[model samples]
Target: MRIVVPAGGIGGARFLRGLKAALGIGADLTEDDPTITVIGNTGDDITLFGLRICPDLDTVMYTLGGGINESQGWGRAEESFAVKEELAAYGMQPTWFGLGDRDVATHIVRTQMMAAGYPLSAVTEALCDRWRPGVRLLPMTDDRVETHVVVADGDGGRRAIHFQEWWIRHRAALPALEIVSVGAEDAKPAPGVVEAIDEADLVLLPPSNPVVSIGSILGVPGVRAALERATVVGVSPIIGGAPVRGMADACLTAIGVETSAEAVAAHFGPDLLDGWLVDTADAGASVEGVTVRARPLYMSDPDATAAIARAALDLALELKGDRP
Candidate 1:
């Protein structure tokens, strides 16, 4: 079996770990091994100190490879921030974003490879070669596509800022006028991205930020068109009325979507998604032309998350059978 997942950062990474467990990849089993391909969102990629940092890609790689800090759910395990501290001591600007010593090495390698003229996909593959994340991790696009937020400048004007600046520095506290995926229109999917979607038995959209994560992936030229051909299932990031993790409500509001499970499902629409998974708290939630299943959606641990992944796969299988 083949499964293709379009994912973002923390939530997507955690859910992927559970999905691998559910597939019996980590277990001592030989049968029912599925080839999983993760299309990671690169819209969050940023250049800090002239080093490229692919946050979502690294989060997925570290989380799946068992090197992610379990507590914070991002960055390296047992990490030290001496580099960041020293930079701050030197009176550097933009000190709010923390870059740990171990994580710095990743950025160094990626930036070096990028400077050598390799595309982002090749750089990501080289990084994953060491992590061996068990899945084929591919960037959504090799082109430089960034998510920028247009927000009030407090001077009766608006200015565009990187998504990380609005997210990390301001904490999405500033009201957003628009969220733009800069360069998305001209960007093509990374190598094997469209093919992975085209050849998949199932496509899974984990509990990632719809506006910035999955939305950015879909914003790539042919990604959404390719996804329309597959049996797609999505797990709602919102539980009852709030995000399970992170400030997804702010992103949803920026995109003018209601922070409800049903609304998110409708936003993706029935044409793209065949089945939708919602939390047990939203049992009565429904959307037209889409099969709805309510289950315990809290990814509290690997076991709990694996159960949710299994439920989504089962629903996809059922939906696949129902197709004429």
Candidate 2:
């Protein structure tokens, strides 16, 4: 089976790990695992200390690659802060975002690759060559596009802020009035992205933040249009009208979106999603053009995450007609 997943940072990476375990247990993927391709959101990427930092890309790389700090689900494990200290010693601006000494090596390599005439998509592939993440990880766009949050200033003035600062510095404490992908209007999907989607038997949406994670992926030209032709199923991150894991509420509030499973489904819309999985807590939530199944969406263990992933794949296979 060929599978394609559009994913975000931490949430998306974790779900993929579970999904891989589930696929491992099934007959479809054993000696020859299903060909899985991931189009990771790059909107949260930022340039820091003259080095390009792709948070979502690195999150997927470290997690799927096995170097992840399991507890944090993002950076490297057994990491140090020596470089962070040195940078801080120089009075660098906006030092709130933590960068580990070991993690800096990744940024260094990526920056080097980019400066040597490679797009982020190419740079990501080179990095993944080391991890052998078991799936083809591609950036949403080779072009530059950053997601910025429009927030209300203390003086009542509205201004756009970098996604990293909004997420790490203030921790999404302030209300975001709007969300924008800075260069999406003209951005094209990276090479091989369309082919992966076109040839996939099924497409999965990880339980990532909709506003920036999946939303940013969709912002790329032809991404949503490609999904319009593939089988798509999404696991709800919101268990009972709130994110089971993160501060998704802050993201939802940005565009006046609600915090319910129903709201999340609406955000993606029935036109794009063939099936939606929600927790048992959200049973009977009607989502148009999508089959709603209420089950446990939490990944308490590898077993639980695998089960949910299998359930989602089964649903996608059963509802292939939703494809255009």
TM-score of each: 0.98, 0.96
Model 2 spans > 4 angstroms off: 25-31, 321-324
Could you give candidate 2's per-residue lDDT for residues 1-324 as a string of tens digits? 899999998888888888888777331335567878999999999999988899898998888888899998889999999988888899988689789987899999999999999988889999988887878899999999999988988797999999888888889887888888999999999999999999999999989998889989998999999998788899998888889877888888887889999889988898788899999999978888888899988888778888888998889988885445
Candidate 1 TM-score, true structure as reference: 0.98
In lDDT terms, how accurate is model 2? 0.88
Candidate 1 residue-wise lDDT, 1-324, digit = tens: 999999999999999999998887862334567989999999999999888999999999999988999999999999999999999999987898879999999999999999999999999999988888888899999999999999988899999999999999999888888999999999999999999999999999999999999999999999999999899999999999999999889999998999999999999999899999999999999999999999999999889999999999999989999877
Q: Which of the numbered candidates is closest to the native, going by highest lDDT?
A: 1
List the global CA lDDT of all models. 0.94, 0.88
Quote the lDDT for 161 in model 2: 96
Error of 2 at 158 (Å): 1.5
